[model samples]
Target: MPRRAGAPEVNAGSMADIAFLLLIFFLVTTTIETDAGLDRMLPPIEPPEEDVIIKQKNIFQVLINKNGQLLADDNIIGLKELRVKAMDFLDNNGDGTCTYCKGKKDAESSDNPTKAIISLKNDRETKYGTYITVQNEIVGAYNDLRNREAQRLYGQDFTDMEATYLNPETPSGVRDELKEKVKRIQDLFPQKFSEAETSTSN
Candidate 1:
């Protein structure tokens, strides 16, 4: 018998079943993940009861241009000096309540830790990386001050104490105590950050 030259037929009877099995397997084994975003607490939305006037000397201005260049108090500054400059401004304590502060006490600087404020202004076109880095440096300044105060008063690091409070299994009483300790440290180096809108064209 001579075989006719024609396209060979394939047995596709199980093709649908195989594809369905594959879909079911993938659906069962694959795990979908949700996005994990930057973990930060936002400020309260309520407006202040009264407007308070702050001295220009007590306000430390930090400007980040669209080019990522930094200006500290109108003076062009490098990233390396930002932390130190912020620390200096915060710890000046010219009002003389910060016994543990080691600042130079310049009259033109902050009058006290309570009075010190950092005003951050950034152009709309600023790079996200630059903005985050600058924010980290400013927060690092506050953390350094808190850590020093925690060590001086409680003989423990601020992070360790924070962990004790943040743990879910911690007893409510113990957490309350830790909260008070954390509050004390915060009182010593209050973080007063104000964000300002600037012209994006710059």
Candidate 2:
């Protein structure tokens, strides 16, 4: 027998089916990663049953000028005094109900210090950095208050301070307290207002 013309020689098989199956498998099994969002606590929409409204006070106002000058009430103060003032305010007004610093109300007095609101007014031209610094100072004040409360609650002998000074294990209770303080500040400034002195100057 001689060679046949155009003889078909086959060895393996079709890969089209395998490729199609693989495409289907990938389409069925592949997962895309999504970004995780920031964690935050949102306020409730409904009003509380008691409806005890706290009045805004001059003692609680901290104003920032366009020049980044800070004023506590009408008096110009440095960041150091700001923390001191905040602590004093919280110490005076704090009710034991506060998670941060539980200040006892004098037997004769009705006003609660912890319930006192800190009103922050920033000029329109104030840098975000200045605002953030003020916020950090405010948070620092709350942290100080929380630490004081911890000392009062657990006594000076507590050893957790060393651990707290380290990473991650520090009680979030202080941070939670700071968040509440920030929430109160946010409530006070529902709408941004120019510092009274700044408004008058312009």
For 39-67, candidate 1 gives per-residue lDDT tens digits of 55677799889998999999999999999
Candidate 1 deviant stretches above 4 angstroms: 13-46, 171-173
Query: Least accurate stretch of 10 residues (summed lDDT) in model 2?
Result: 188-197
Clashes of 2: 5
Per-residue alpha-carbon lDDT of candidate 2 for residues 139-186, written as tens digits (9 for 90 to 100) = 566566555544665553122443344346556886564444444433
| Cand. 2 Cα-lDDT | 0.59
Candidate 1 — worst ten consecutive residues by lDDT sum?
A: 35-44
Clashing residue pairs in candidate 2 (N, C-alpha, C atoms within 3 angstroms)? 93-112, 93-113, 93-114, 94-113, 94-114
The lDDT for every candidate, in the order shown, is 0.90, 0.59
